[model samples]
Target: MSTVAPRFRSHAEDILDALRENPDREALVHGHRRVTAGEFHDLVHRTAWAMQGQGIERGQTVTLLSGNLPEAIAVRYAAHLIGAQVNHLYTGLSADVQAAIVHDVETRALVVDPRLADRAAAIVEAVPVKSVLALGPSATADDLLALAATRTTDPFPGQAGPDDICAIRHTGGTTGHPKGICTTYRQVREQRKAGRAGAIETDAARQLVATTIAHAAGMLADGVLESGGTVVMLDDFDPADVLTTVERERITHLWLLPPLLYQLLDHPAMGHTDTSTLRQVLYGGCQSSPARIADAVRRLGPVLVQGYGQNEGGLISVLTPADHDPDDPERLRTAGRILDGVEVEIRDEDGSALPDGEHGEICVRSAMVMQGYWKQPELTASVLRNGWLRTGDIGFRDAEGYLTVVDRLKDMIVVVGGHVYTTELEDLLNSHPDVRQCAVFGVRDEDGMERVHAAVLLAPGATTDSDELRALVRAERGAMYVPARITFPDELPLTDVGKPDKKELRRRATTPTT
Candidate 1:
């Protein structure tokens, strides 16, 4: 045993301790492979040893490019155990986007999932990285798993301090650079100590992870493991597959974005699939349709949970299972009560508090609030005022203490699926040869869902239609960034300051051409 003592241990060590309680319990399930608690614990230790040998020191960033693989989760724990900051790249992002993030995050070691070897290769070729490793064998990088096999699975003291940063999760789909929220090891322990992760989970209380582990799913998975619960990983979310998996695994907890939940509810399999084992159907990546959510509550029983949060604000509020009242549409529209120990205040542009019924930006103060945006002091100062995280989200709290998020102050548009930054889309659109000028904004549909909209002016001798330009965006930034409505006007509206008149463009987007 190493005698090196650290200021404190991370939640990673706590999870390892929990794994021994029932060593034979099924801890991880990925396709045909089943990992018992003992096996996973061993894998984590081996991985930590491998990374340590490679000089993965505390606070060094380890960026991962993987799907929902069990090994990917193990890598996260391994990195955490070694006290390295982990930055998980979301899979669907363009190669350049991933490279930009990896470069900005100052990654010391890049871990690739064998399945994403090609993608990793592209990033590796683009960026000058220190070391590259893969979860399994691939020509793109060194095999981390194979390296781990040669190492001993010996337990060691955690090399992290309570105040040391542990995770850096990016808030934007930013292609230009990386900006992320920083969370410390102390906050991780505080989150657990505060009982925000819910009651203790049994081995029988299985959680299904169909979403990307780079975001909320990762947090949920960690909580599940800390409580000694089993986790079933899905490489991709097919509505039918999710339904069958829920029934097959006897899953007690499932998490989804509103769009994904809608897809599952609409799927033919949902009607026949046995979902009686489900204790919670947690959903909330964006503002959801109340009517659709009400429909879900009626169909799936009173198990729907909507967690309203931000990367910077942590989980501000939670719409509990008991709060999913189908009879009260008004209640369903609300984002539920502010969570315990979390203080929320509605503030206007001048930073003065707003009345309960008035809408303003929701500011939060709590243990879950991030330390700050990683290395961006100016941006951090803009949001973090006197220990409060100014969530760019615009919402109002009723006299009853229920929040109703009606709009967002940020330029990013939040859909049922994902947030598309208008600036990022505009930047992409302006890069095209056919574009003279372009402006992007969001407009709400009749269903109260935000849709991306753009106005463009073609350069001389150019004749690109909206469809062609949309295809370019869809190809470059993925479907989420594709404009729902693209209008090729003779000239784009401009403000007096010569800036693209996005406000006017937004109005024009909502008002169709005659």
Candidate 2:
């Protein structure tokens, strides 16, 4: 009988094919370093071969701790091609948390950056991984790059199938332990495909990725590589450097969080920066300042795209560049229409679908939704009902097919005589002239009763009193929506993933004074 070809295609192989098409073309840039498609291709294969030599095989987990380096990207693909699941230790998380994650994933190989050698050694001391490979020569770990250099550049078919586990990205660790969101190769591939298609499939574009590559930028980077585009990596985000890079690189694509976007807009360089070459600025992680967004649209051309989704469900919807209309301000508040190949429904507590305008839990169904929370079958069952993943976000759909996510299902504040939606108040606060940034959360008193608490960051030279803020909320939303206790913090806390850190905010509100 003739040999049968596998049904599933690996995303790694997709990059390999793209790399083969133009070996000499510049593929990646980091400061002074320039890597061509040929070099990146060889790096992926060589890393894969080196891992295999260390006995890393299919179904094993490969955890990484590194900055946004080109080799980190190669390591991710190399693990994928070898059928190893990948997980990244986020920079902001505590060592204990990272150790717990490493133990939870049962990581077989720990690929670390030379800079993070101490952190990697700490993890190894606690978790005892089978292999410790450093991106470069280090005191604690063996040099993986040196070993890879000895391997041939011969390409091999990917070891994993479509349904095999490709990644186990953990949640932001808001709730006790961070739950690992396990995604299969098929789920990951389809998610990227849908994202690329919705964003307009392009052949080539220079994209600047300034966020953490272990999370949002990771998927975007894969898409950029597959399209034969150049990715300019930034170790850290400086509004000045980002603006300069855009003007220097003639960057066509740029992705950033809303806060970072606002900083870029307000930066002094923004006035002189040549941002006319920008094609689109993809932003989404949390609620954005509508005023700043409109300002960006006025300053830059009409090229603001907002992606709305969570880890449980990939990208559920996107507010396209066209949706950022200056005239229709109400549309700016919306999360936009559901993406293609994705199904979204506003369901009530009983799991029944609600009609438009009725607020309920936002549920989504698509090939992109995670397979399940890693090894948590019961938890998975509670959310994934009949192929639909229940996103804990509470929102309603308008008649025009736009989704508006209000307060989170868990974040609904139970006040003295009624309930308060945090977003309702935060949105109102964000509209005020003096408010720079704010996060509203509920904290329990000694009687185990919840009261509204707000941590706000006032704009420079702003003297808006807490009384005025409360008065504004009372007038706009209602008395109940006003913050019971308002504290003007130096800065609002944000999670590693860029979302508002309500947990930490709540802790601060409840904790006793020194």
Which candidate has the top score in lDDT?
2
For model 2, the local distance difference test gives 0.86
lDDT of 1: 0.80
- Compare the candidates by TM-score and give the number of the best one: 2
TM-score of 2: 0.97
- The digit string of per-residue lDDT tens for model 2 on 304-375 reads 898998877989888999999866768888888888789989999998999999989999999899999888
Which pairs in model 2 have colliding backbones? none
Provide the overall lDDT of each model, using Cα atoms, as 2-decimal numbers: 0.80, 0.86
TM-score of each model, paired residue for residue: 0.80, 0.97
Candidate 1 matches the true fold with a TM-score of 0.80
Candidate 1, residue 410: Cα displacement in angstroms equals 2.7
Lowest lDDT 10-mer window, candidate 1?
194-203
